[model samples]
Target: MVLLKNYISLRDQAEIVRICHILGVGPGGLQRPGYSTGHKLQLHRTCFGRNWNQETKCQERYNRDGSIPPLVPPELVSLIVTSVQDARSHVNSHDELPLMSPDTALVNFYTATGRLGLHQDRDESPYSIRRGLPVVSFSIGDTSEFLFGHSRDEDKLKNVLLESGDILIFGGRSRLIFHGVRTIFPNSAPPSLLQKLKLKPGRLNLTFRQF
Candidate 1:
């Protein structure tokens, strides 16, 4: 069984570095592409499901309906599964997390001028497992402000800077906790990666999901 501990990466950096190198952020040497949301709110998630986490783990997030963009190709789904498996090997079973398998990848791209509010990956239809599922998130390009909270949206919150190659996993008991990205660290990313990309900010995130 995996143990629940705080910032497991701080104590196990070698393992973290190995995994980050193995699981580089952004698509596997692919260019970023643009897609249309049809200019509409497809609202695949609901507030009820969002509330469940609030009452339980106080989390509010779920699987997105969008698929990986075509222009900006990313690693194959199977490859991510493999990478997730490889990364899990570094987890501290007795002090960090238990076994988990991330199947779906919700790739998020942000620009230096963009901002994402605080939210949690809780109500995702596929991860609605009452006990909650682990969300394996990888951050690449530019450091950003990552916020975390305990229960209510307004509580003892913590802010952490998530730079390129940072992997954050939240699930199990922590799955429903409220969390979000506040701001981008402007120009904290590589010029080559940002200037060459079609997307803004040059930051891309791939979150592995079981759904």
Candidate 2:
């Protein structure tokens, strides 16, 4: 079963598939970072596209050129902004996700035997720029161990199981909360999603921001 409703959850398999497919269309599009024990710390500080200069805990950009599509997509920006219009209906509602206005979505992928460590997404300016705004994150594919911490300190973290089709939104007091993926249960995916991703052990994370 899934846990960690505040930051992650199991979502609609079909819609998750569609989003994953569409994510690759961008030039410096989404990424499937080869996971390693360092993945969590590495990605937490990694920067993508054109925003590296600003990240406090930066990581290598997914693209070879270290460039990415804009933090905010011009054409689909509006649609993405409105994507969470009904967010309030969900567990982590819109009213709490203030950054929903300038929604920027970043896709990160993890493959077999991959694991991510505990960390926080405090690099994006939105977390501080738009006060009290929460970042909306979506997870699909194989299950993984998720951790949430009150701060960067080791003693404050809590672990949870994150399954396919999960949606996580952290805002308000939880906005700056520390979180990250620990380990991916490789080869444990549902056959259909595995097929969608070519039957590999992996999970795609899409984070929405209001930039």
- Among all candidates shown, the one with the greatest lDDT: 2
Each model's C-alpha lDDT? 0.48, 0.54
| Candidate 1 Cα errors over 4 Å, as ranges | 1-96, 125-128, 153-155, 191-200
lDDT value, residue 131 of candidate 1 = 44
lDDT of 1 by residue, 116-148 (tens): 556666545653455465666666667778788
Residue-by-residue lDDT tens digits, candidate 2, 146-204: 78888767677787766675566666667767777778877666676666556335766
What TM-score do all the candidates reach, one by one?
0.55, 0.65
Query: How much is 21 displaced in model 2, in angstroms?
Result: 4.5
Root-mean-square deviation per candidate: 10.0, 5.8
* lDDT: worst 10-residue window of model 1: 42-51
For every model shown, the clashing-pair count is 11, 24
